[model samples]
Target: MALTSKDFKYVSYLWDDAKAASLQGDEVALLLYRSNLLGADLRLTNYGGGNTSCKTTEKDPLTGTDVRVMYIKGSGGDLGTLKRNGLAGLYLDRLHALKKIYRGLEHEDEMVALFNHCIYDLDSKAPSIDTPLHAFLPFNHVDHLHPDAAIAIAASKDGKQINEALFEGQIGWVDWQRPGFDLGLKLQACLEESPGIKGILLGGHGLFTWGDTAYESYVNTLEVIEKYSAYLHENFGKKKPVFGGVKMQSLAPEKRKEQAAALAPVLRGFCSSYTRMVGHFTDDERVLEFINSKEVARLAKMGTSCPDHFLRTKICPLVLDLSPDAALNDSQALKEKLQPAFDGYREYYRQYYEDHKHPNSPGMRDPNPVIILYPGVGMFAFAKNKQTARVAAEFYTNAINVMKGAEAVSEYVSLPLQEAFDIEYWLLEEAKLQRMPKPKPLSGKVALVTGSGGGIGKAVAEKLAGEGACVVVTDINDERLKETAEEFTKAFSRDGFITAHLDVTRGDTIESCLKEAILAFGGVDIIVNNAGLSISKTLENTTLKDWDLLQDVLVKGQFLVSRAAVTVIKKQGLDGDIVNIVSKNALVSGPNNVGYGAAKAAQLHMSRLMAAELGGDHIRVNVVNPDAVIQGSNIWAGGWAEGRAKAYGISVEELPAYYAKRTLLHETILPEDIANAVFVFTGGLLSKSTGNVLNVDGGVAAAFVR
Candidate 1:
């Protein structure tokens, strides 16, 4: 059949007949294709929120005969990026046979372990908890999606009645039941009772649709969601004002962002009280509309209705009590109110865990809210990493859409507190958490590396990111910045780091770069002042311009960047590190290096001074001195190598060997070597030590710290 050739008001129709036809014979491939298409659209399903399955005939290794196999999305895998290996293939017969031994709802979790025996492929990924939901359904192809429009209908107070009326009984309605063996049975019973029903609306949950063919299943899922979206929009339009109308106007775009940036580090600090958390901020129109609305407090308290929504966002978001305008106008007052707000959220969350948690439940996870809503400013979502934080924000945004749609048509209804608690602390969910890999040492840290477009700065950024810190790679060279960003994207994925063009000598640029870092990953926790240029000349040859330029780039640049970042660091109230990349010349005092050496000496002393002053704030300031980081060094590229070679009476090629020979260890220092020294100072290895200098010059006695 021709794919739905029509315009969709909410979601895009991306089904291509040619693409579907290409995978016609491969049932699993078709399922993956369908899943990808659906998952690509946020309006259809959220990240890692839904699952799809297709039954295929595969040869059995034991019997050497054909057997029916169900391939479904694996646990914790996202459909949009699903690959062939990400699908778990289970023997359909074995899955069906396990039902005979199913004791009841109480023992449903046991069935999850038993699923291992049903694996069709030994190399298959772990099956999702929703496996039974797909296995028990009689259709050859099935799709279980958490589409916002469908979820809005399902989360409505009269969800069952609305489902019956909206689809004219074509789609059956099942009251709220946490997904597991029992819910699967309920789906089977619903279908058994009404074999003509096309889909099912799971109350306070999502929608389930199926078909005889993969394409048909894909189309059916879209059609159901589209109908609901159109219906909801029509009703939403009819209402004079949504979400009880806006309670207050949004701060202007710039002001809103400014407010968000100011609040992010403080909020992040609160969220990270127990364990460090990375934060993501959003000022999207939908978020602004919900938070600025009259019913925001009540609806936020009610929490999210969709299981997928709350799973990432927590039971509910903590709404900031302060007004946006007030937050923007008075920074000090905003900070005062924020502390109490966070304290209250923690107490409430602690009580929630105590009130509902079973003795066997995994000890309460972090008591901090994953999501925080600021009226007129925006929303902040915190998680252990940047991507997770960003995804959590996206999920909450989806929740907002779901709430809006539900409120427009019928009063929105969240899951009962008990039900919500059970799902949040589910043993199976706890097991999934246990399965996650241990976080890297620098996981929640954010670093801003100036001059990171190349050389020591790039190496330091890369090293920090490898250890799990989100990095902001800033440099004045636009071309190199782009290259570094692209390279980092390949190495660490897009979320690992952000690139900003920053001329460190310029105060405005320094402020802009710090603001970018704050907005990108909440705030900077580690500062690498590596941006610099060198001028090697005797006192006579070194003109006033030469002396001034060296000082501006080396000394003043570090001062501006550090001063700006300290403002953010103080707001976070977290221990911070500033690693200034000074040089051996600062201590050695060689000929023709007067201008460069003076600047390096100034930078070294400045770091010591900052360490003494900022010690009260727990912000450590240190220095990394490198003799000659010639390889991949932009400083060396700009005639410094030639000048140094001339001074040493050798060619530029001999500089590395000469420097290495001079060191007691006879080792040539690379940019990565400098990067490692910086990490040692900032990576909690020397947490108690501050105002110290680490020389990465392979043991230059003259450069050794006294």
Candidate 2:
């Protein structure tokens, strides 16, 4: 069956109910992981554009009371697939208290933060900015969305006119107001004014409808949007203008030439695919009727329904009248003509702010017109995204609809620029920016680690990631590096760990990998030069090839990556850090380890010089020398024990005791210990110290570094 207007209404309402359903079950989250309705609603609207909430009763552990509380969805969650914990449970009383702050204070931003604080640090997730709206509603579940049809109706001059046509006397109408407490307050008033009001339309805004069930709500939403959409289809689209068919009175040739120069540069960027488009505008029969009609044309109201619409549609359209054979003129002349219009827009903003925001606090973006609708120039809506332009398009369509309504005498007026400012700068709004979680201190910070697949590298990445740093994990093999990225995506954090194939010895690859890490994680904060190779050979017979192999990986790779990281660090004005994974070879002489010993020694010494030179920028440099470690391990594995046994002329089984017995203090060195050391040195604990080598060899190499 073809879906009717009623079906669409019910479906739209179902979205809100579905939002409630999502947070109630873990299964729902799995079902709609990325396409949550809550996300759709918010992203579709402007500024925390939507709201979400859920109902659950948890037993209070302290009082043993079955407190009826809600795990309301927080401000940042996408509703498409919310898990149970995505809902932050607010003590009904705490939310009620936060509500008082909104009523008593003049700031809406503050109120939002107060609501956020009540939610974020709680054992639950952060409460959404829409929490209060959900609280005021009379349902176990509630959600709000900006259905495109409804926004079109709400933002147009005929909002009240559209409301009259559809619901007539059945639903209530509200004047324009900023979202949040004011909306909630007016919504409450509408509920009282028309107890039977099934829904409401806020003039120059959108609609709100509720239902007892998801199906009921979804259906209502769809029906409402369809109803308005049909109204528009019938009223405004009867005869969209065709350039050649219309009288060419609006597109005088001279104005058409100016129009071409004004709009080409702006349209060029988004329309790379569109080879050409001619610009034309006339009073749609509706505009002409509007101009003649007392409601639209009276008082020389020759403008679009809303002054804000000018930002979307441009102040006016440039009528194109020139012949196809005409060549375009210089853009500079066009810019000069448009410059005054831009300044006029600035003055409007200045006046708007001056009138509305006393002791102004809210920062306004560029006030220049968002579009250039040159009559002969192609129509373009200025916006950062396709979505906003779509909004602009709807605004234009709505304007066409409302102009018909304006055939009657009275016209719609919105809150003045100053009242809008007071609303925009309201305490609750400003306060929302306050007490934001002390930025996790790791934002935009980056760290790179070698040999990060399974053990120490993994630990370090997770730890730093938990603190909010972006981590890049590298390994010689593609499989290992990608596996690390995948595992971290699941077990650690998504978008936290990146992988690269880096052998380290290849200078070109090292440089390229460093660039890749920056592009992935912003820039490097710490470099854990933890990859190395070791072999046991007597100095007398250690082949030049074997010697170079150890030196290449240990010294060359470690040095190159460290140097690359330092250059970026200095460029960023950061006090960078380098942690070299030196070994027990630097501390002690093991019998069959001539090649490994000489290589590690050079790497170790290079670290000391790095510390001395990089110290001026507060760049920390350190070495973690571990030996007698089991190599290829879950714990410091990878040729570690093999090297020790080969040096001592003993089997691997006996080397553990040999090292422990020789140490000043007998302590088993876990990889966690090395990871912790890396943490300690890179972060605050060791900030005052650098160029220090820490022996991580279970004290076996104490004599060497000491």
Candidate 3:
């Protein structure tokens, strides 16, 4: 618990100077800087967690009058990368006045309207519920964060006493109260009573610190947290707590990954009927150690350490069963094993709500579990999209850390059940939910892309992710695969992109890639078989080695990967799509390229057979045959470009234009053009079409079927 302090780097170097100069708003810039510094540290605030504010005066454009404004982090803004517009400017006077008449309000439903009404600028985003807290404080800057070190103390039974002792009687304490108008007023009262207080700790909630400037406020926050951390470190001194006497049972590490891979698709398929859930598996030693502990079943059932997690992660997570027999079974068999467990979970959730909820309470949320504890396989989080699933996973991981700290000091304690329910159904959070954007077309779908190291495969994977599909990128070259995954991580989250090293020709390797894909993203809804190699040699001159290599990759690779992927798609019981990228030579032979031509022809025929067979499973299979897509395509790389140019009797530089002139449209096809056709077929845009070959070679009449 020794305070873990990060070396703070001045972030002005990270900002774009020209962009900053164009928008020269001092308060906005300062707020952004402060938010980034504080939010960058996960120990201080998580991705979208925590709120910050600054009280400033801005001259009204129309009135030429200076007005006091409170700029709080707008709802749904991630503090780690906050921008100027991420803050909502509301008139302080108007927000403060609402508190005066808040006591007479019968219900909190009007909170959203009241907050919206106080917005001075019509274009400003909606302010957070904690705007009142920021306004109630007299300081120019205020920060409210659920820092782990602070929350560990705040969630303890002796939280107040701990705070008083750690802060030398300068900190104020308010009993656990749901955040809103009432809690804001109570915090104001506490500060007034202890006029010399530096900050206040809301029992069982989080920490609040204020200062005259953003820097001062940020420093005060760190100091308070350091004090809490030191208090635990000095007393606990690396002492581990033994919470239970019973022996723990768990699968070995290798078995855990093996089992998780087999079971993830089954669970994902079962949950699909009610919610589109993507699953992420983590076997970080800490997670495995804790999840496998005998005490986990009892302690995990209590509740989350804080209310912030309740909305994203329900109060309690579902603990799934892991039988050895179930792991080796197919998705259908696994489903049979999970159906009873899911039924019991639903029944328990219903009874728990009936026992705690009032008659007029809001209806129950989706009873599906957010975090699933796979006893032997570690942990899995299921959510509508990858980002959310990762968020839940991170939150649960944090919860384990916090609960361990609390238990080490003493038995863990949770906030009252009624308060937990109140926060879970808060009007402001509900408004935020309503404001959430609609899901994308392929939101819940998982896509597996082969040859995604670059070129057509990479383009297809990127487009699929943009359309909201969780993409699993696979390539033979491990370095290229890693680079592609890094790029995908920058675009979406790491959860949205999973990478696998696969030699498509290797049967065992193909099987492993499919399992890893299912383990990472639940099940595959889209498959892009773009991995192949070329051999420019005549049938008589082609060596046996060259012919076997070409056939192994071009023909056998597609067959093997599709064979495994089709199993997952069928087990998921969802309509799926497969797009095979073949060569135009498949329809029209290329001179002296016998090995590649024959293999591609074989693939085209195999695709038709797969379509005929898998159509019964509602899986659409189609093929895209392109003549010369040399721009950003690796198929023509490795001296093949030179060979193709020699065959066309043109220089390498003139090959593209030569091919372009060959097509009726006189246009050279790009990798993205091929990707677009793949998207149209796989995205269900052409649901009625299957077993079709799309010639993406700029209108090649010679390659056209009709």
Which candidate tops lDDT? 1
> What tens digits encode model 3's per-residue C-alpha lDDT throughout 438-510?
8887898898889988988999899888888999899998988888877887898766778998899888988
Model 1: lDDT of residue 299? 93
Best by TM-score: 1
The lDDT, on a scale of 0 to 1, for candidate 1 is: 0.89
Clashes of each: 0, 68, 0
Off by over 4 Å in 1: 1-6, 327-333
What is the lDDT for 588 in model 1?
89
**Which segments of model 2 are wrong by more than 4 Å?**
1-49, 54-132, 135-141, 146-176, 190-207, 219-444, 631-640, 700-706
> Native-vs-model 2 lDDT?
0.56
- Write the residue-wise lDDT of candidate 2 on 272-374 in tens digits: 2121111122223433333322232222223343433433453332222233223434334434454555556557656666655555476653444443333
The TM-score measured for candidate 3 stands at: 0.88
Q: Pairing residues by index, what is the TM-score of model 1?
A: 0.98
Which portions of model 3 miss their true places by more than 4 Å?
Answer: 1-28, 60-66, 103-105, 120-123, 165-168, 233-242, 249-252, 323-331, 351-364, 415-418, 478-493, 515-519, 570-573, 638-658, 661-666, 686-689
Please, what is the TM-score per model? 0.98, 0.61, 0.88
Worst 10 residues of 3 by lDDT: 7-16
